[model samples]
Target: MAMNGETKTKAKSNLSKRGSKALTPFSPYIDAVNQAKSCQWSPSNEEGFFLMATAESVLSFDLVHEKIRTCREVPATVGLYGNFRGGDRLRSAIAKMMERTFMGVEVNSAHICISSGVTAVLDLFFFATCDPGDGCLIPAPYFPAFDNDMSIRNEVQPIPVQPADTHTYIPTAEEMEKAVVEAAKRGVKPRVLLITNPGNPLGTLYPEATLKELLLWAVNRGLHVLSDEIYANSKFGSSPDEFISMEKVAQNAVLENLLSAELVAEFVHTAYGMSKDFGMNGFRVGSLHTRSKDLLNFWQNMGMFAAVSNDTQHALAVMLEDENFVDSYVSENKRRLKKSYELLTTNFKTANLHFMSACAAMFCWLDLRSVLAESTFKAESELWKEILEECHIVLTPGEACHYGEPGFFRVCYASMPPNQLQVACDRLTAFIEKKRRKRKAANIS
Candidate 1:
């Protein structure tokens, strides 16, 4: 096929920005290793010194027993290498579960394409839906990995929607709409809007009404919605009825009254995983749900290039089929999360620090302006570095999450044990006090 003169000109313009330079490869594992080396080690040489980003829950005897039983029950045929690409039976089972529990009204076995994990699903979705240099809209204070994955690895341009407030980490729908329009005007029109529901760092769960509005807006703009609902079941202080899936919202007449089914169908892609909800990070199982036949066909073609491991798919299928197990697991985790949030909130309140509202998820977004105001550290990243150096405490700086302000940090409540959480709170309070005293002494001098 011959390219038109206009198309050739646009290609040349894009190529000019590249300047014939090769892209740099990103290795997160290498980064993690270097970070670990820079940090102090305890005299005891204990592993507890470094807190993990997301740690799996300690499995109870019952859960362990169930897993053992499931392993035994898994057939020899299921273990065969041919089943390594995921079997139809396992896919069908997962699809059925999605249809029944997830409000996936029209899902079938064929609609399901198993992936190694949420990251794999995202990579596949990007491969299927976007070309290199295509635009993807990601809200600020996002999962940092996504920026690395989409922008760095996939060669996609990430148009950031900055958070309204550094503390809140909530980007308003209006702001998002404006960003999309602006991106389109810049000739980098977004093909996908990535939303991390029960948001990362901020931990705010979007109300059904808010999600509906966003969906409608995306449909109007001809943008695809990639809903990252991995934290869907981690909601604190919310009932199951309060949680709304994109599929459910799209199907609701009163909720999506303005948008027709055809419009709604085009805009939605849901990504859910067992890692966040079940605390099974090692499982690496996740699903991508979409109603668009065209999108599904594209994904199917992409799957031909790469597929998920069959063993993991079978494990996920078994887990999904056992609703009772998932319910019990979610219930216990929710209780733990609620309690952790309460403890953290109490500590922050005692220190005269405030956190933005966090209804669900593992993190609490904190405003560090009061602490920053009295410190020599001019930026949040510097403050974070100082904290690590002086207090030996580690928290994600908001700047790293794409919030430009130098007055916010994210504390992960889920990864810390109860005692560790208490110690962390004490260290934070002490750090604030120490900084205050230094400022006061300097003022006196």
Candidate 2:
């Protein structure tokens, strides 16, 4: 409790200067991960703690395993070094997948670069585009790992674009421009604009108009736009707003003459992987789509350090090549995600807890501000610790995601079975009710 996510404390150490500097003072995300490793709840272990803090999905592992079993035979080319960028078949498969899912944008395999994961893809991109101390404009309440991913080794500074309205937490073009101006005042050179489509934690898609506005702002600023579409295919529920890729937006802008073709070609880029959408985090496979030749060459040469294994690439390519399997797998995964979401939200409604209505991604942005003792991040962290210790469940605290305000938590439903998630919800409701009763009792006294 003393080492909350908001506070930073450093101790004297013999570690390298960079390593010591990278030591995060508080990380509810990493703490939850370690906790889950030791005492995670499952069907076999009913008494164990429920880990609803992570963003992984285990609902469709059976489906993935069954399909992957058929692709076990590796090619002879896999024995020796093939393409360091990525295997030809895998890149081609990814291109097609992007074309189909990213709203009919024609993706060429030649423009794609593969790495071990989206984290690595981003690291490589930032390392190439930014000098040390260059700032990247990212909307706050974002994926917390982005801080370490872009900053730790790349030495890039992540400048948070605080939203005018924290309730939605979606930044407007005006807000982004203001953030860039603020960064300039602080002597931070802004280089890139990062977007997490079907946004992390929020689990909502950017309205098409908002997406266009943000992209055009980046174009005007001559900043590279890196769209993280890791959750592109995991969308579900009844949101009428469709998921639009950054590539399509930029292409349309160029066609409309709102943005120059050369600018779009050089600046618009996207990152994707099998981790979130396909529930294939263990695969360690991710790809970047870019039209910039310089970026492609940089990553192509540097990718050797982070290249995915040929065997992994071959298996994923096989999975992607099968239309029926990929389609069925995606549909089934969505159905399961929807069911899990409903299971969690149904309990929330019963407890009268407020949460952002999410239509994509695996998170439910739950509001516990009413239950907090005060309206501060400290209170939020205290509530998070209370829930973990008392209910034996792990929920990502708002401060962990660098949310603008307090008492909001990112509850992941897809990490465990629906039945297990139901147990987690039950424990959370009981905790909420207990707090409500205590407040009422104190008021009466």
> Candidates' TM-scores?
0.82, 0.96
Candidate 1 lDDT over residue span 373-444, tens digit each: 533334655676666555555566666577666687777776656656777677778888888789899789
TM-score for predicted model 2 compared with the true structure: 0.96
- Top candidate by TM-score: 2
- After superposition, the stretches of candidate 2 with alpha carbons farther than 4 Å from their true spots are 1-10, 23-29
In order, candidate lDDTs are: 0.67, 0.87
| C-alpha root-mean-square deviation, each candidate | 8.0, 2.1
Give lDDT: candidate 1, residue 312. Answer: 61
**Candidate 1 minimal-lDDT segment of 10 residues:** 1-10
Inter-residue clash pairs, candidate 1: none
